[model samples]
Target chain A: MEKRVTFRGWMLPLLLILPQVVISAVFFFYPAGQAIWQSLFIQDPFGLSARFVGIDNFTFLLSDPFYRASFVTTAVFSVLVTLCSMVPALFLAVLADRLIKGSGVYRTLLIWPYAVAPAVAGVLWLFMFNTRVGIISWYLGTLGYDWNYVLNGGEAMGLVVVASSWGRISYNFLFFFAALQAVPRSVIEAAAIDGARFWRRFFTIVLPLLSPTTFFLLVVNVVYAFFETFGVIHTITAGGPQQSTTILVYKVYADGFVGQDLGSSSAQSVILLLVVGLLTVIQFKFIEKRVHY
Target chain B: MRKSLIGALLASATVLSPLAAYAETEVQFWHAFTGRLGELVKAQVEEFNNSQSDYVVVESHKGNYSETLNAGIAGFRAREQPHILMVFEVGTATMMSAKGATKPVYEVMAESGATFDPNAYIGSVKGYYTSTDGEMLSLPFNSSTPVLWVNRDAFEAAGVDPDTDLSTWQKVGETLTALKAGGEECPLVTAWQSWIHLENFSAYHDVPFASKHNGFAGLDTELMLNGEAQVKHLSAMGEWARDGKFIYTGRRNEGGANFRSGECALFTESSAGYAGIKAEAEFDFDVRPLPYWDGVGNAPQNTIIGGASLWVLEGHDAEEYKGVGEFLAYLSSSDVQAKWHQDTGYLPITAEAGEATRAAGFYDENPGTDIAVIQMTAKEPTANSKGLRLGSFDQIRGIIDEELEAIWAGDKSAQEAMDSAKERGDTLLRRFETANN
Candidate 1:
């Protein structure tokens, strides 16, 4: 039996959701519609003149090898950022969960990186890894290993991925730690009495209970890696060393704002929108089935 | 005739002071200068304001060059553009293509009845921001050209001559070898590699960087940067990069820090590198002319300029434009121009300003301060040596940077890289042609 709070009239429900609908329309839907419309035209930097090219921008983008390469780069960056951020975060969360002494302090310390902006995190990593003047690269030079990401494509990609994931790990740690605390104590206690080891009981019982949080984080972090890591990529590599580190969002900024190619940039964003939407749909359709919640 | 009339009104209005002038026209100026340069620009605006009671010029420091141009365009779209916007050299083509967005400087000067002499400008710098018929479209505010920056301390430390004659690329290669063998980590590092290496390289060697008189002749121009001269030079640089003589730095001026810190022996950077090197270098430094290939006929052609210029935007009234014209006259005055050129290492745009700076002994006091000016005016510019006027050049430069990086990384040969760059750049040029046409 469930208690239902049915709306007495349609007006109240509409009024309750009005603010949300308005915000989404203004911030999300309107801009998305504008991007789609703008994609069909070519214009100078000034909007005084515009030509209706009608899908030429999209055709150009799809035909560009560099643009196609960026799709692969974005996918690789998203996966690397997700795995690198999540594993260490889960480990830290599990370690903090076991702490009986000063657990709050440990948890607070673990969550501090989330407060840092993505660009700042990138600069910090850049300072340590800069080829000529960086402390870490200087030490590596003393050991006789050449470290110049400015020329090496693989090194540039590796550096941007690490820099992008640095702040995201702190965010995932917060969610994972909160979920770890909410696990039922009775279940762990009962498992301990069944001659099961701590590792086995934790994996089989506690980890299964944290599925909903994990699934949610997976969705959020994948979206974050796709869109929100532009700052880190820009500050660290600027999609350079032969465009090896050029993620999709960074290309959007580079083409649209920096290059002033608005039509092609809008076409790129529409493609990115479809990509993320399809990724979300796939995740919800398949991955959600495995989640107990 | 109209220009002279506005010039007369400006003089009479000033002479009459508060009685004759009913209103002080407000003129807005947007620029992309910051730090010491930003303060200097603010001071110039203040001086202009203080010098006149008939007009007031308000100067705002927009973000960087790209941001300032975008802001001007966005403002134009909103019908709120500044009276004048400072645009970088790469954006000249885009500015020219958008016919209604700008008010040509010659027209502004003519219509406002302001006193302006087009012949007063240096040919190379003036040629960059002009129409095909030699109509000045923008005022050349702060022009700079590429020069070889040498860190004397690093050179001496590597057992090389601090005053080596680096007149030709052949000589530079010999010095680079000596510096590397003497245990220099960075024998040669450059800022704005594409500018110093390829674009200016083509100009200095009197080779076309693009077809159609380097795109000044027509919109159908294709990149000629993949020609024999350019490929040969890039190949030599690529060989140096392979031998650890030419250390590749980050794309922009990130190498400025390495050079300033005495980590690099030889730096190929803008002559305006003077501003930073003067303030920051703990080691002694010197400026030299950009090197050229030894074999080309009349090889050491002038290098092209690489700084921002002032272009008046549309949507401003005639009264405000008179203020703009008056302000431009004040800015290009000998006193102000000499001071700006002496302070920032930018070339004095006006010939009178250069002569005044020389007459005032500023050049003698500052050893290498006049190098950029001399290098720019050293020869009457040929079709190949004048300047690039390609649309979508900013994006084209990005493609060039990418391909050059591949050459430096030993992933592609110089010929292959330049060919790819030309192919990629021509595509953008075609797109710009269709869009603008």
Candidate 2:
């Protein structure tokens, strides 16, 4: 009994956090700290011409129109993509929960897009939206839409949002579906017996119960929308038919590696990190409170 | 008696053995070339390794042009930098500012006492890689200029003249309209938006892409993409985008597949596209000189370079540097240069190789091969015609692409897009200036 207690006391923390700590130090802290350090001065490959620029990079970034637009775009993209993904995902999750036959097949099919890598997804989407031979182009042409995302701002944004949501839907759906499955079937049955209709039971019982999963997914989807979609943006529009699709991370890439403006890139990165960080905190503080769990 | 016999045998073996004198020096080469180009590079390395015994050269495909540059930067931060790296033309200013990060090619050759002659290279190619003082910094390899790729079958399918004179933007615009009118949806598509459209477009019109020798002069230079001529041209493209005549694919030769599939009649792509076009294109296609804005100037001036070049990285032993020098010499050899130029449709770096190619009747046999050279060397490059030297040009190009896309989408006019791009790009320039300073 003593041995077991001692093992639980001493080894539990290590078992729980040893991997986390190691990964954090290796991958997260190291790069983040290095970026911060590098951000303090300018780096030229000839040898570093580092002057202690201090907060000059940040100040410069604030004044830059490109950086500002990127921030705006990232915010807009994150919110729009998250909303677009979540609404459809929740609907599908709820619909699947109510199904009796072939529900598994439907679920599997819906979840299929999650298996694709972002790079592959980008390529697939690009092909589907290709002006020359795209499947969507054919359908859109039939529907009387010109289907020219390259020539329409609204269409460009719509395509990006849709392409982004296609992969994200499955991810959100899985979470919501799992949460839905976990809801007490007895409680739902009781509510149904008490004369609660489909909408009433869903609103009063199912949705409230699945709030935790929705909240968690919302945060994750927002981050994904902001950071991971750069590949899609780069591969699809390259932030064009003009800067319509250029978001924060792509801007960071352009400034640092493409522009060789490491200071400015770092500045952009710092802003992105802060924005994401703040959003994460707000999710925890506000939305998480309302979650059932 | 057994121990005495073993001792005698050991003693005899020791006396007969020769001492090993030296170890091999290793050099790391990071390049962007993949597939065929990658194989060619490896073959060259293998040949060099076989020719000598003292040094070993390791070549790694870092990534494509931008990715390779990113990898080089990341590697430097990690202190795992290769001894040699391939940087695209736009990265010239970035490399130049990395003072201690690089050992200039001229100095390396001088230090190694190799038979290096800068004059052997063509003037235009060398001029781009040279320092302000005319001292070469990097060796130009795989240099190319944008050219027009014509799908004759597509043209004929549309019932348009296959030999249509597409010398000016006005003519190409008219041809595109005709092609679309004749039921050709994807008539014209382009690769490298900022490269062919803004950079080469500026040079071809004898106008400046950026100020101060395209930013080679100082970091204070701003983008000139918002100029009157640039605005006019962009608006024209925007109009085509609306009419479904021009399609904008993702950056980095996304239209290569479209062109290769023989769906697009006219493509503005790097001359290096020739190698792939020749290999994959089943239909009859032809290379032509890049079209210009006939109204912009009296006539077309010249095209600027694309592709990439080899830059020597610092942090290597003298023996390794010696091997690098020798390998570079081999790569620049007349036979090697001529072959690479002919095979890849990249420019011949050396005058001798260009002359040899001409003498060999390669250009005569293959029409339009000399178009890039003729276009680039049409006249002595003025400050305006000289290549852009802006630091972080890749980022700026992205901005230009974004703004240009806006124009195409009709969200903003060309004038508005360029204005925004300039405003956005100048902020980066100022930041680059302050940081570099």
Task: Find the candidate with the highest lDDT and give its number.
Answer: 1
Worst 10 residues of 1 chain A by lDDT: A41-50
Error of 1 at B224 (Å): 1.2
Q: List model 1 lDDT by residue over B241-275, tens digit each.
A: 99999988878998899899989998999988899
Model 2 over residues A1-293: C-alpha lDDT tens digits?
45553454768878878999999999989888777876776655433666777887787777655557767877788889999999999999999988999999999999999988876787898889887689989898999977877656567777888888889999999989898999989999999999999999999898888888888888899999988987777777767655667788887876676666666566677778888899899989988878888
Overall lDDT per candidate, in order of appearance: 0.89, 0.81
Off by over 4 Å in 2: A1-42, A45-47, A98-113, A142-144, B1-23, B177-181, B243-245
Q: Write the per-residue lDDT of candidate 1 for residues A116-189, one digit (tens) a residue.
A: 89999999999999997699999999999999899998888889889888888889999999999999899899
lDDT of 2 at B354: 89
